[model samples]
Target: MDIRFDGKVAIVTGAARGIGYVCAEMLVESGAKVAIVDILADTLAEAVETLGKKGTVKGYQLDLTKVEDIAPTVSKIREEMGEIDVLIQVAGILAGNPAEKITVAEWDKVMNVNSRSVFFMMQAVTGQSMIPRKSGSIVNFASIAGIRGMKEPLCSAHYSASKGAVVQLTQQGAVEWAKHDIRVNAVAPGGVLTNAMKSAPPEMLKNAIEPIPLKRLSKPEDIAAGVCFLASDVAANMITGQTLIIDGGGAVVGV
Candidate 1:
């Protein structure tokens, strides 16, 4: 692949496992120093052990949902490791039920973890470093469900709406940050295999896939690869405020 990030530093949130872990591994292998941030305290330590072989890897166990936690965590990384060149947001939550059955607590939890954290984390990272440098990239992990209503809605109204918010948030952030030379883009993925996916019920899974053109689920690496492209200047030089749909062309139908 002609891409090499020999002198860059990256932050991959929710890196304890799944796509976030994969993103961190990919970035480090491509020659960028990476910090793996996750709320899973024990698992974060294990991720560092595996991902630290290439370049440099730092492990941070922080709950991104805490409004005040992101800034200081980012500050600590910057204080010790110089500036971050890339920030990949992969933390997310999904709880699906009929809208009528979805409780307020469920809705709030999904929005706060999946959508709200992205906003604050972006503010902290860009606020403290990227914006001023006028050169950095932010890759958000939005979902295909964000672009359109799920063909088979497994999640309640809130999950889809929260992802939709991420899509617009990416656009807004991109537009506002472009002048700072920072790029913000999102990878809206189709059904990807992850720890989270295993929790879905058979009926919910069936509904989620019937409309996908590919007729098959997406791989975590598939989504991670797209995220890496967006984070790298080589692939997304002129791209910003755009949501790259990696959905097996599902959006072609109605999305």
Candidate 2:
């Protein structure tokens, strides 16, 4: 299907690299004027420069952890990018620690970025733009880790917990915001071959892939395709409160 977002305005967080960057690139290619938000100033600038070649694209450098600043930053995006039509919450962090070895500080760090930032960003975008217009689509980035436990070297209790919160948050937003004509959903990706994954030891990468029904890690584009579908108002209009699993059938085999 040829999906398009011509003339729409979108906000994509954590869009400097990996799956986030690919989503921003695809959105621009589809003709949406995009506001790519990230905490990495240098990388954000580079992303804007590259994506600008395709279509209208801008970058906003803001730390999502500072929840207080989200509203104002979103307001600025509105002033600059026009009324936001879609929001792709793709910014998140991951850590690996056994449940018993996890620290409070580590837990807080992951939750702040992955869970807290997601809720507040949704609130800021929905209230400032979508609710007033009574129209919008939101796609939150969740993980397979949130839905199932992992074996050693990949397990992190706090990371899983934060993603679980995201799944719930997406559902809550969908139920509460449906009356306003907004659709909220999530994309749970598993074992994507991002730069971080590519850098892992060969054995570790192999171990990660062996459990998949499709014995290969997902490309960033694979996840981006699912995200764009969920973020498309025309494509996913009737879909809400759903979590689309883009895991190469890993979930099917209990991976």
Candidate 3:
């Protein structure tokens, strides 16, 4: 089936590279005007330039961890890109440490980036754009680690805990915003070979792939397709507060 987002204004955080970049690209290709946000200004600019060649795309450099700045950033996006029609919260950080070795600072950093920022971003976007318009779609990035905690040397307790929060936040936001015509959902990916994952030690990478029924790491495009589906009104209008797992059957295999 064909999915079209003509005239939609979309904001995709962490759009500088990997999954977020692919999401933004897909939205543009599907006829949406996209504003791509990321902490890396240079990379964000490059992304915008590349995606612009395909369709309308702009870049914003912002530190998502600064939760206080989220509202203002949303304001800026609405001002520059027009009222938001869709928001994909794909900006996240990964930290791995044994529970005993994880320091307070490490835990706080992970939580702030992975969980707290996501909530506030939604608040900002909903308050300034979606809520006022009474219509929008929000797709967040969660992880398989969040659904089921991971063992040592794979995922830190902090990362897992933060993602678990994302799962709950998506549910809460969806329930609270449904009356306003806002849909909140999340995409939980397993072992995607993004730039970060490509940097993993060979042994670590091997261990990650072993449990996947597909026997291969997911590509960024795999997750991007899922995000596009959730963001599409014609495709998922009735779907909300759900975490769609795109793990190559890893979740089914008990990974």
lDDT of each: 0.86, 0.94, 0.91
Misplaced by over 4 Å in model 2 are none
Residue 39 shift from truth in candidate 3, angstroms: 0.7
Q: Which runs in model 1 stand beyond 4 Å of their true positions?
A: 151-153, 195-211
Worst 10 residues of 2 by lDDT: 145-154
**Which of candidates 1 and 3 reaches a greater lDDT?**
3
List clash counts for every candidate, in order: 0, 0, 0
Please give the ranking of all candidate structures by TM-score, highest first, separated by commas: 2, 3, 1
Task: List model 2 lDDT by residue over 151-197, tens digit each.
Answer: 78889999999999999999999999999999999999999999988
Provide the lDDT at 140 for model 1. Answer: 91
- As for candidate 3, its clashing pairs are none
Question: Best-fitting candidate, measured by lDDT?
Answer: 2
Give the Cα-based TM-score of candidate 3 against the true structure: 0.96
List ranges where model 3 is wrong by over 4 Å. Answer: 199-201
Candidate 1 per-residue lDDT over residues 1-255, each given as its tens digit: 566677998999988899899888888888899988899998999989888766699998888778788899999999877898999999887666877888888888889988999999999999999988889999998887777666445546888888999999999999999999999999988778677787878786776678878886778888888888889898789999999998777778763
TM-score of each: 0.92, 0.98, 0.96
**What TM-score would candidate 1 get against the native?**
0.92
103 Cα displacement, candidate 1 (Å): 1.8
